[model samples]
Target: MSFQWTFLATFLYCELIVVIILLLPFISPRIWQKFFNSRLAKAFAAGAKYYFNFIICVFGLLFLDSIRELRKYANIDSKDLSAPHAEAHARMKQFRSQRNFYIAGFALFLWFVIKRLINLLVACAREMSAAAEAHKQAEGATRHLEGVMAKDPTKIDPREIIASPNNPPRYVEAKEHEFEIKKYKQEISKAKEDIDTLRKEYEQSMKKYNELQDEHQKSQIQLAKLSDNESSKDK
Candidate 1:
């Protein structure tokens, strides 16, 4: 029981501070945003996370040691209770009560661990949500551009706006966009030409194969007749 008390006191007084540090990112995202972006802060967070894990491991070891101490103390206590001396028996009872109090301290450690896990999960969810939003925006922009490109290309000339001083910003931007659309259109045309060339080559190859197969079949039939005549002559 004394061992349990020692464990509780250690965790409450010392380990609790480290747990708060671990939870700071989740407790206040503003703090995370301010500090997490800096190189020093990132490095510190990495080091702190590592140190926190190390501290948890140490706590585990101490808990194990406490368990052993508790068992040993319990054995001594059982013997003391049986002793005729009331002084030692009262002392042992007090020690047992103290150790029992330490048993609840492990739950505190468990609470901290759970909080840390939730913080990590929250950070991951935030990043995934941001990424999803960015992808949605990009897809929307792409669809809008495709719609514009589907219209008549002759109407979207950048050169007409270039010589005019009163041209709007949109005209200049549209001109740049027109150049991109034209380049993409040319690429599409080239791709179509390549596809046609490949199709023609494939047809030509199939025709040649059929012609060769027909010639081979005719030669095989002629050979068979010559062999039959030679066999009859030999007989």
Candidate 2:
């Protein structure tokens, strides 16, 4: 081969390698996700991915080396395809075929990795959201329990106004009661704020409920009118 022919072949091979690398990411997204999600699979995929890259690099270097040899041969004697040259040519041709096969396989793997990863992420998000919602409901229930304890009539809950005529001012008990009263007052303020917020939410929900009821009534009236029209038509 001439120097120009050798250069053209090298350029074409490099282009082919680039195209294969670019396609791998899109084709193996799911495979990547699955592999990355588990520790064992992640390790395996990392090793495999690196090995694949290494093999591609080796092939690329070999291709370049072969092209350089071809250029050297062309420079020395353009027409000779003798023993050593023929052997080199055969190896280069074999490498090209093997490279194509590797490219196709890697592309499939890449696609699989990406798809699996996306699914895992969506599942994880849904689980996290459900957990958060449950926590919020539990916290609300706890706050309501605390408020009920603060206001129970029978239970001499230390948190409320426990004023009695006989226990006018025993200094120790008075101080303890003062502290409890202060704590309950703070809780009361917080509960009031919550009640205001809930009132607004209830009002909005009631407004929507009334709107739906009105819509239902309208729909009933329309249905009755249609029935009457049909009855008249029959008559």
Candidate 3:
């Protein structure tokens, strides 16, 4: 469970990194001025260059065109600040490819998760329903056998053999009884397995949700720090 949560957290981190990279052009310059004297701006400029280049390389042709456009916007914004626009511009010129890979990928992944949950719930419900139906069938069979026996004469009767254990109803080898028990056991086991699977998925999802919450808090803190630092500089 712990290992699974760790892997989920790592996946969440990659997702965040991708989102931040995609938003870099729109967010970075607004947070930092173009002036060379601004230390944070220089770091931001360097990171922007490295980050976009890295995206072009790693994501390759799949995200080429969208990335190029993004890089172009970032370059113009960088130029407004007298930052290294040429490097970003040059990369966009060199690599001409485009895809909204992240948006599509994220959406597909979400759809998959939703689809899986829907499938699991539907299957579980069916299993439980089958189990209930089996129980009803078995009860009905037993009740029928009891009624047949009660109608028989407890003393001497036409079909009742005095020495026979299953005298009248003779249910021990009845095909219906065997069938009922077999069907009930099978359905009940299936229902139990489905219930266990549902529980595991719920637990994993809960853990993932908690990890996401922690990551969100950390990002909020970082944003707060940026705001505080800006304010303190003015003061």
Candidate 4:
């Protein structure tokens, strides 16, 4: 085999190994996800699309060449077949071309399959992680609701807040309404307190203004009296 063909065969073997490893039952999606997310994998993934496309194109060209060669050899001249050595050589060429065709074709097919399997495993891992987080949140909420119910059983029932085995909608509209009403009441009370504080401040400001006015009036009267006495003394 030529160097290029040998390289292709090696690549095909590597792909086959990878597919086998991926299909192994003991290897979980989580492990695959971690490997794919690693720094080394990320660096490769950055150019993986272009790299895979280049490889596919090369394999496609090789496959086409193999097909052409196979067809060329299949139509060997009758003169060539008359010679036994020539016939055997032509047959050998045809077999090699056939082998190359299968190699390139399988390699190309396996490339797509490997890409798809990796994507599926990564997606599965992410979905599993999300599901676990959701379950944790649900459990925490259930525990909190249980605590709240323990304090005030009449206010909220556990069944009304938490979903049952059938996964019914948690009917908390009444509880939400009550909470809103209580919040509004607190806001109204706060507004009233602010209004009372403002009213007291306004009253104090008016009192101060009145005191200043009285002082100004008394000063004006004293100035007038002093002016009249000075005028009398001059007279």
lDDT of 2 by residue, 113-190 (tens): 444555555575567668889997777666656666786434333333345797543234557488898999999999
Tens digits of per-residue lDDT for model 1, 90-166: 76665764454364446446656755654775586578679889997777666655555776444444423335468
Ranking by TM-score: 4, 1, 2, 3
Which candidate should be chosen as best, given lDDT against the real structure?
Answer: 4
TM-score of candidate 2 versus the correct structure, residues matched by position: 0.30
Whole-model lDDT values for every prediction? 0.66, 0.61, 0.56, 0.87
TM-score to true structure, per model: 0.39, 0.30, 0.28, 0.61
Q: Score candidate 4 by TM-score against the native.
A: 0.61
Best by TM-score: 4
lDDT of 3 by residue, 1-235 (tens): 2343344345545665644543455533223222333676467657765764554354344334346555665443444445556766555543432224343334335434533443454565567768889997777666656656776443323322334556445434457488898999999999999999999999999999999999999999999999999999999
The better candidate by TM-score, 1 or 4, is: 4
Model 1 scores a C-alpha lDDT of 0.66
| Cα distance off (Å), candidate 3, residue 106 | 95
> Candidate 4: lDDT over CA atoms?
0.87
Better of 2 and 4 by TM-score: 4
Model 3 regions more than 4 Å off: 1-175
Give the RMSD in angstroms, all C-alphas superposed, for model 1. Answer: 14.3
Residue 232 alpha-carbon offset, candidate 3, angstroms: 1.0
